[model samples]
Target chain A: MFTRNPAGLAALLTFVLSAAMVFAQAPNLGKPVSPAEIAAWDINVLPDGSGLPPGSGTPADGARIYTAKCSACHGPEGKGGPSARLVGGEPVKNMSSEKTIAGFWPYSTTLFDYIRRAMPWQQPRSLTNEEVYALTAYILSQNQLIGERDAMNAQTLPKVRMPNRDGFIVRFPDRTP
Target chain B: MNKTPSDRIKRELTDLQAVAGNGLLHRRALLRGGAALAGAMTGYTLLPSALGQQLTDDAWSRVPGSTVPDYGSRSRFEKDVVRTLSNPKGEPRTQHARTPHHLINGTFTPNGLHFVISHAGDPDIEPDKHRLVIHGLVKQPLVFTLDTLARYPMVSRMAFVECGGNSAPLFSPQPIQASVQALHGLVSCSEWTGVPLSTLLDEAGIDPKAKWLIAEGGDSPHLSRSVPLSKAMDDAMIALYQNGERIMPGNGYPMRLLLPGWEGNMNTKWVRRIQLTEGPGMTFYESRTYAAILPGGKAYQFYFMQEVKSFITHPSPGLAMKGPGFYEISGIAYSGYGRIAKVMVSADGGKSWAQAALQEPVHSKAFTRFRAPWRWDGGPAVLQSRAWDEAGYAQPTRTQLVAARGETAQVPPVTAFPSQHYNAIVSWSVERGGEVKHVYA
Candidate 1:
């Protein structure tokens, strides 16, 4: 087919040469890692419960942990405090209004994710998977989004619908996933 | 050629002319050299008394200078020029260090004074033990140490990382009385050198299903944000060096993820992992903290771009006009879209504007200094700057911006971020007494 058009043949040769040049430029220095080896550092939990660890807890277990570990900065039962209030929030009337789990959080999985990685500000990443699930259950239950007896696990955490789930509009829709 | 100093000064002063209303001189007047500009500075051309002072050797000129240290430091006289910290006590919360824009000039912010918003205090991470891993949704999960990343082919670029709420105080119904640093200082630029994220991702062999990548930091909070996979392939970098040295601890020592022109929080500091995934993580930072609330109660999520914005730094609040004879109104103009196309200066509110000259080699997404020659008559004047980006977006005026993004019902504290991504025109009113203050004109 190229014999009928010499220009087409030249174009194809140039494209192949440029593609080769591009492939040659990558350094390819990354050492292959195993999934088991990455587990220690892989703490991220997505909204779809992609990385949630296998654990379960109820609001009762979470209340005991919250009083012992979190009440100092977060105030008793996650009311207003020196830090941020985590429980009930007045509806977000304006931009300045306080954002709480019930008022503004979009996904319940984010609560589990944040608590697992950053809660109890001074001692971060100290909570076990079960403790994180319990805290998530307690916060959700306090916000009246979940029942007091509902045990939160990897399966149930992502299923809890947040009050402000549909409140957000992606500013740049075209640029997102 | 034999003219006296007075004759030359008078001639130069006479040559200067106003280009716009309220004594805005020709932009090229700055190019006329220091002697001419100096004469213009003093309302009168003749500085006979100053010129008559005897030229005696000063104490510093007579004695040898102090010994130099191994690491350089700015002059002690410049000690006052430093970042203002929001949490000096290092409390258990996010701390903000704002750059002093009025005190400094030029495009690149010094490494020591770069604005930092540390969720927890800066972590003291030892470079030797630090590891960077790329996993999830890739053909092969990969790991790289700091030393290995340093060996790769690296590129350098000047980029500005601006917080989504940099100038949030401007969202107040009434302009808050504050310095330019207090109002607009969260954004800063520096030359960042790093290996392209695409090169590393290419080595990992991306799966076709991967659409987003979650970048996490090694800081105590383990702060993380999900970035579009397309951006990672475009211009993202695993930046190792900032301003020709190892990155500062506050700015993410060892390494940080540099997403040029994106929200500041998304550029995770002390970045340790990049996990490619099928969708956004919808992490705490994105799902709540950075999401901006709009009028009618709905919020705007993923507002990534720091849009076209500019503010007069020299004559802004706290920098008095100094009897303003011929003052050059200058400040920073930048846009995430591209290079700044044009900047217009208005001495009398936004009624009439004179085009300001943009500094040469204006890099995309970096601070471009815009200067306008002004011959202020020392009367009441509301000074403002409006910038336009190459992408055809103009910085909206105060009235226009407030109409679109509602202002606070009550004035917010200067430190409060009521809303995010505020990129409107900033106005500074100059009084007859030469005192400049924040204004809503």
Candidate 2:
């Protein structure tokens, strides 16, 4: 089996052997994550409306649904709670007052995405997209932003400026405003 | 004499004391005693011989039903100690959560209630697919699978991983009236067992030119930061096991890098990539944020070492003292530098000091529990606890940290922007009604 030049074949053999060793030894080298996966899970929506999901809801529809599914915890008038009160948009001069969805939170999208993922703790993710829309609408209506008869959809959801939109600043390690 | 199980539990403490040769032998004794107390077959002189036998029998076995673990947790009794959901309605996958410290015991936080601050949400990453890559300035860039890591001999240590930004809320002018655990519980201790990173670096052959190694997590947005290579080679561990078993899902499951005594963020979770680079990873986390300026205009950079600190876990705010008859003042004391040697509690502010009895087996970088017998006179008393570590570092008050750093002087101007890292002597004003509220007398 002698050949004029077996050096190329020997080199080829070495390369193949080395490649096999690398894979066999380290089987789980991670691949660069894909963009699609990032989008699917990055559900955090900023107040300036950066991560708002595509869809919409009206205050009128939100009200009817709010009374049915949400009012149980948030209270019928959205002011008291078996659950959290949805009213009270701003902290008052009185530090002892109860701060609710309006006064305590800094963003409105937090409400939409929050309800979309974690509402009805006993039965999370039980609401439909339209129902979440309607519920959001009712909350906005209760907040005095939209009318009870108005419909809200994704296009309008981000545009529904929250009264406390300017209230939030990113809390980080050090540096205060 | 061959003593019964309970007697053994007691002897374990003595043995532990003998082993430590230091006052910290209480635990070695208790654990050994507890084991023997359960296993001893012989009877003892004290109590009924049947009681000794019963102790042995109890040690020999738990009820068949109680031993069966289909779905498991630390214990139902320890269930009151749990993590607070930061977002009542955000994705549990990425949302930040924390442990409830008001109800815990001793210094070690159960793996379940350890605090979490995740990025890009929590990835349901499979253990089989976990990988750790070591590249950058090295003789050879290498990728390590979990099995390959397991093949190496492991070292177990009761170490702590604390967030550099832990106790962020303490900067507020007002007392954050939550449990001490909720506020500072971002720090937790576990007996982490894994391969020392130095061994891997030795295998891969770290370059003399390489100054920093950037660690990146497998979570989306994959939190990353640059750490000094010197620190990595010193005490850094690629921890695969936490508290004896595989790492918890919330903690870097499969494997995470435990940079002892350093900030928690540097201990990346779901740790897949380790690029050996001289520069920072440039991830939005470590770059744009985490760097804060100090008073003299110099910035506190890299990972920060948490100073000596201790918090009274029991009898915290929102906790009722039950009219203060004979109450046990118990809590955890720990330091990033080394073991905590002393803990002193003051019932009437820091006017008087009484040494707390430290539990045995006081390990390095782990929580050391201390307890003291207290009799509340049902009057106005401000309760506080102070811890001193072996390094001679004492827990500082808020005034010291603020005056030293001069941080945020311009931020709030007059409102007195709460100083971050305000390791002040927290006081709790105990009322006659068993009500406890955070106070700064």
Candidate 3:
């Protein structure tokens, strides 16, 4: 066939070469992320405890960890310190005021997620899962939201109700006076 | 002082000649001014050297300057600094830097002067290693690199991003004496260019049951927010460029989630991952920090759309009136829902109002400049502006907002009312001596 039509053979060869070049240039725009890679970065915990890692911690253990790691910035008892206050302040009444994890935070899971992802002010994402759970328990117990001896695991953390859980009302598209 | 345009130009030229004769224009000064003029001519000028140098010497000299061009830095002379509010003893990473709105003019905010509200500080990432993974509840989970995403079809848009607590300080009983930018600088408008998120989501083939997509950043906090899929498919974009240039490091270099008209925090910067889900992730920012307490002791959550709001930039706190005679009252009005219909200017407090002229091409979810002609008799007066959107939503007064949202005691002193969205009418009191100040009417 090539011998019969030399021009056609030349055009065919050019087309094939260009196609090969295009494929070769961009071998893979980006490699497919493996499930293991996703798991390493997918550390988000939902309100229903979807991303909670396997860990257990008591409020007593949390108190000790809080003193060692968090107290420098978040105050001695997580009340009115250089960093954001974690424990004190009243719940949402008729008047708007400062928000605390126990009084304002709707999900207990958020405490764990926030502390695990960003805490200690200077060093972030450095706490172990057990340390995060213990810190959450200590902050909650200090606010009188959880029992002092209650061990916060994946199951109990989600079950722990927050004061402002039902306080939030969806008023997005229709926010009239 | 009542000179026409041509007369003003001639007078300015005479003044320049007089200054030159007085030998005030030194060779170094002339060189600097000439460079500034050349920069202005080429449209590469960041700020006028006269203003930039003064401001730099005053406060910003201590901060570092950008050496690399790709990273993008501001002019040293630019006086519009981000007023940072943070604990002096704690790490400065977790702080809010307010944009100087009063110092800026027109609709589009300069990238360098844009406000920043950092929850866990800015992160440094390598673009070559940066990857955006789209998984969860999809037929084909895909991972895209910066170059790959850039290869897709691109779209450009102009929108605004406002922090949920932009005007929380206005809730104070006594009017806060601050520049408009210092008080409301958390909000900023920019022209963003990138590929539509819907195009990527379509390629991934989203599942019918997926309701929310969690957008996570690569920063230390890994800042994440659950954005509704409807919005994602409607107008959301993974922005790669800002104001016709590559995104800056401070403003989410490489990639950012540009959610038009949504709360600023929802537009995650340095975006790295997006996971489709059936419900909101209920992250710390969404469930707690951004929520506002209402009158009935209930908190308002997911209050995404910024309501109608407007404020007079000229004759504001910083820019005093020079023996007010004939002046054009200028300001900006914007709405998240739709285009601005009208802006009403009130010089006699709330007793009477006059409709101000809206600038042409009032784009939706963007800043619309407005101006009204006024002849002041050099008397004490109160200036205010009220905005109305195409949706018939009128900007509320401070009293009305307080009545609707309720107010707390002045315990924190910084913010008396913690309502995340406070789009109320802002008032500026003018004294007989041509001094202007913020006031609550």
Candidate 4:
């Protein structure tokens, strides 16, 4: 599928040959990526609970994990200390209180995805799948969206309706004029 | 220090005034003193002389002794440095630098002065070690090194990438007293050269059910964004060159996704992988940050396009008008939807507007320079520019914007975060003494 002009081809050939002579080796442009290799890097989770790893955790377990890992940045009660607040605020429509995940986030899956990929601020992606699930459950419980003993898994997590689930407008109509 | 070009011009003007006679110079000096006194009596805060001196013509002049031997460097005299803002901790690793828009003219923004907003730190990637992998729901998963990717057919286009938070401070109830660049400098235009993303997707043979593509970067935090398949196949490109040169390190060196006219955050820098997906990735960037919080509590998610916007660059704050006789009012206009069809300039606070001359080669989804000739009568006036795009969207006034969105109280410690798409008509109030200030008219 790759097409190059004659001049470009000539330039590439010259570059490859000269570089090979200097290093005494021909460069391997690239190899076909295998499915296993793709699995190693495919970490994204969708709104529909796709790409979620097989794991489960209770909110009680999540509270302890959050205290040890996330409380430093998110605050003891998830009311925001230095980083973003995870709970306790009105939806963005009120415009009176600060926006928190409980008040503003529309999808619960984002909480799991973000925590798995870029949470803890200092050491990201170091959490196990169970730890991620526990943290997600703890944050949601603190938001009062779920009970303390509720077990969160791929199935239960996607079913939890956030307070701002219907608070988002997807159609960005051109309001220019 | 050697005298700058502007300093020399000012010296020559002073010499001419001296050679002419004492009468004219004396009268002019008296008038200036009286104006300053009047401004002082009216309690109008004046810009510091030191700051005003920096805004001299030298700020807009090309760098002296600059050469393009193999690489390019800005002129030594050019002092349009990017202004930065960081968190209270004073960490330099994570900070945002605003472009000096007021100091620059024309559409092309210099590479050095381009605004930078990094969530984590910029990554250091070696081109030879970098690899782009396309996988997931594709017939053939392919991985290509930089050299192999460079062999694809190339295309070039001029476009603007604006931060979703560009002009976000305008949402503040109280007007922010700052230069135009400090206020709305996050957006910049450039000539980008790359291979169309469709070519690679076609080569990989995308699945019929794949509706979204998750583009991930190699930067720390591994910044990622989900792009629709339609946009990916439409105008998306794997940019390798910026402004006729290899992409700068801060701007995704070896390769980056170029989503023309989309929010700058969506243009993932240091791009590493593209995974064809069946749904939105629902990353933090899309769901939490960069989402616009509208009035009545409904936040607008995944709003990508930056609407039509324009600003008056010359005669803005910092560049004090020298008597304001015959001035060429010049500014830039751009649209995310399409080309700028018309730009109207008004000197009387939108009372009446005259169509400005649109610069040639007005490319779609790019910055188009506009100019108009105006003779100030040494009176108070407000200068404003309104842009219209081919989509028939005209820039709205601040009042209209606030009305459409909800108005927040202009109280101290204001923090009513509005939507990210703020393209209201900006007005600059000019005093009789030639001082200008940003105003909402």
Candidate 5:
């Protein structure tokens, strides 16, 4: 199971052989699973938002509702309090500090999807699309990413520019490059 | 310095006089004593001078630690090293247990009492019947039992794994007496033996289109997570052994995935299946538990990798020191990327930095220790430390992080960060009264 490649195969075989040559090695143990059972278990989100459900929210509707339910732990402005901070600030402060949502969030759809599902701290999945949109608007407005009057529909929300939109550093670039 | 009955009583009185804020010690003195790192110089514990005596008899030839027991456990001298806080309600959720931070010293956290954050509590699994399946966006779907995995050659890594919510209370200005382990012991490092994800993916014959992979747990709630294909291909692994033993039941007994430097939530425990996928699992734990809420009310997407950060566990608030004498300054530093190249200790906050000694055999993506001999003066002074990973990423400051990431109406997303990542420095002022307090300015 662990040895997947042919190159690794030779190494593994040599290792198992040497171990056998040493301790006469014990018998194999542990049962395997059925194939069909595995197909039933696979699930994960995608970069293209493939796993995202069919739903959209506007920032206008997200603001009012968010202030009442989320303003406490996340702070009235979204900077953060005792819980995790969710919005505003320059994404990475001086290249070292990767803080703030308005500064770091890569995609806008995550806003709608995240609120529609997990939120309110105490009660998850309690907010509707309209409330989520208003809250989103309020948060973005607070971050200065969007204006107070701006209605963050599906189109406008995606267009919203985050400071770190193109700033993500690709890992191990020079090592392989 | 052995404390007399009166002296012990006097110390206890001083401890009671200590105030608390936001679950943290208002004064660094609150951290001293029966507290972790407390009284290093002032004398909470000292190796008996008798330990340094020379032996001329055959007893000198005796192998030290020859009395080692079969089962490795915390030192009896450090008996209080157990989880200080636990879910009082018990089964209300996962069997969440806090680490005994004050009791444990050094960079690595032993597995026995490592903080546990399971979704539906721990599951009792029969290792013999366990199975691991690899399918999804893979050319050749694969299924392996515990036996098949054991056949594969394994590699070991001494690295740290931390929960995203470690030290969640540190965000507040008030000191929270909740205990240091409860505040920051969610992280621990060990010698993890396993097969690399690249090897597993090669075996699974993953499809090129695979952008994500779903890792499912064998436990009751079946805690599952979606890891980025890039990270999986880069440094992910299927760990079978921890420390020197088969993975303990409290840990992922049969097996658990170790996502180097990634958030604890994603390294699904009791790993059952790893399905190569084109999308995320969107498990309740993800969409509901780990997701972050924004200022306006909307939440953000997943940022799984934990950034570079470190803390000076020693001389932290609550511990007391001997009166103005020599003390060994030490602490552990680890990164999700690689080894910590250099650790700079600042006695004057972050204003200036001085080099600290890096412990030998500094392993990559693992905890490396740093130490220095400190000559303390019985007066006011602030102490702090900062770490730079091998990749040249220096720990940031709290003010800098806050300025970069502003306040929001909703709980900001803690995808990449479980707690504040501003590793700028934590300072404690040693007052003339021999008192230490957490200071900001």
Candidate 6:
């Protein structure tokens, strides 16, 4: 290599050095984590139901869980008390009207995702996957969006189309990923 | 004897003429040493003082100061200048602490008085135990602790985090009689110093299929929001320090996700996890809480940016004018798109507008303070400020906004959110008696 022109050799060396400097900028202090180590904290469920866990429950099963764990704040049968009313809503005549599950929610997976992540206001994420599915089923059935006996699970939950499924218009399509 | 500062202020005022209707003076009047001259003669002329009183040392000047505290705090006299809390007892529901904008000035919101809306109240998180995990759609799953993150290359930027529901009360059919704090207190700006999220993501090696990332907090609610990967690669930061200090507990101590110019709800506080994915999670917030219903019954979804907005903070509701002489009309103007380009003050509602002077070094996505001189004529007038962003978007007038997004059927409570993303002009009516009230104009 030294037999080549001196300036050409120097240019090649400079190119390699600059690339090394650029790639080495980051401190790279993060520690590698295993899938098992992250299993406990990875609870997010997407609209496509990719993150939904192994669970199954019917509206009947959800009614019992809602009465025991959710009724105090959300009221009996999701009519709503101190917290938001989860069961019913009108035709959304104006912006100020109460937005209910039947009236505003566009995706059914959001019900399961929200209930699993944050519900029973006082204690969240303490419910099991079965309890979350049950509560989601109970609210959906109460809103007359699903059958009373239909079971909700990873496979069937995403299929339940909400009433307001076509009610949303993406505000900024260019910025949306 | 030297002429008093009040005499100098009066002499300076004589040369300034009204640039617009309702005695709106030129913006340069304040820059020409008018405010500084008026500052020296503030209390004596405004308050009832004995004539020819001799200058003497007051009690505070005669005594030594109190012992210094290990952690410095605001003076006791500033105790009343605090955030107004919606739920002081920490009830089961969400709690809100609104910043007192009228009582405070400048662009940076003090950490103590920064607005916070904790869904399940702030958690007492130990910094040592806290860990941030970034997994999914990455070449390698990585976990970072507070200590590890502190070692990364850091950058500081002044940005604003505004709640989507801020200024929602303006959507009511009639103006709500409330303070500026009650109406527009959910938004605040701070200088955040942090590690660029792209740096860490690049270290982890992002997968090409990843389109969005779900950010979750460590609070009880485990509040989560989905952000576009494009934004994460843009100006997003894992903010660890706010205003050169460790972040406040209420404002997400240890760390928080700071998505500059985005809706506040997307800036997940107490951020513990970021899971990259192919699509939006459509979390409860984006799906329901933040979606604003339009007049046609279709709701606006994924409305991330806080649009251009401005409101006069001085002489706002509850801040009555003092006898209607020379007054400096000042307020804040900001935008999520970019820097505020221009701010026009109209003393006659939307008619006869005059330009206001914008303070220098106007950082993008941060509050830009604007001031204009006005000689209040002790007559009825409507005060309004309209801002234009660098992106060329003008703040909408009340009629323009209401036409696009219909108003509420009934007047809403000051705290209730009638709609989301209510960015429009705010009008304050100055009565003949110098009292200012919220008006629709």
lDDT accuracy of residue B331 in candidate 4: 89
User: What is the Å distance of residue B150 in model 3 from its true position?
Assistant: 1.0
Error of 6 at B183 (Å): 0.7
lDDT of 2 by residue, A1-177 (tens): 226669977887899999987744532232333335334333434334544566667776676777777676667888867555686545422212233455544445556666665565545557776777777777877877777677766567667665544433233222221
Better candidate number, 3 or 5, judged by lDDT: 3
What DockQ was computed for model 6? 0.61
Show what share of the native A-B interface contacts model 1 retains.
0.75
Model 1, position A130, has a per-residue lDDT of 95
In terms of lDDT, which candidate is stronger, 3 or 4?
A: 3
Taking the tens digit of each residue's C-alpha lDDT, what string does model 3 give over A1-177? 899999999999999999987743422344456667788777788889998999999999999999998888788878856677888787767545567776678889988888887776678778888999998889888988888999999999999988878888887656574
Q: The CA-based lDDT of model 5 is what?
A: 0.62
Candidate 3: fraction of native contacts reproduced: 0.67
What is the Cα-based lDDT of residue B227 in candidate 1? 94
Interface RMSD of each: 2.4, 11.2, 3.1, 4.0, 9.0, 2.3
TM-scores of chain A in all candidate models: 0.86, 0.67, 0.78, 0.77, 0.59, 0.86
Report the Cα RMSD per candidate.
2.9, 12.9, 10.9, 10.8, 12.6, 3.6
lDDT of 1 by residue, B1-441 (tens): 599766766776688766677888777777764645666466466555756668899899989999989999999899999999989999888899999999999888999889999999999999999999999999999999998898898999999999888998988888899999988989999999999999999889999999999999999999999999998999999999999999999999999999988899999899999999999999999988988887777888888788889999988899987775768789999988889999999998988888998899999999999998887777999899999999888998878877776877788778876647788889999999999989888
| Residue B400 accuracy (lDDT) in model 4 | 85
Which regions in candidate 2 have their CA more than 4 angstroms from the true location?
A1-177, B1-67, B74-80, B91-94, B279-283, B295-298, B405-420
Best by DockQ: 6
Ranking by TM-score: 1, 6, 4, 3, 5, 2
List where candidate 3 sits over 4 angstroms from the true fold: A1-31, A94-96, B1-93, B411-419
State the displacement of the C-alpha of residue B322, model 6, in Å, after optimal TM-score superposition.
Answer: 0.9
- The segments of candidate 4 whose C-alpha lies over 4 angstroms from its true place after superposition are A1-31, A94-97, A172-177, B1-72, B87-94, B409-419
Instruction: Kindly indicate the candidate among 1 and 6 with the higher DockQ.
Output: 6
Candidate 3 docking category? acceptable
Report lDDT (Cα) of residue A30, candidate 1: 84
Give candidate 1 misplaced runs (Cα > 4 Å).
A1-23, A173-177, B1-16, B37-49
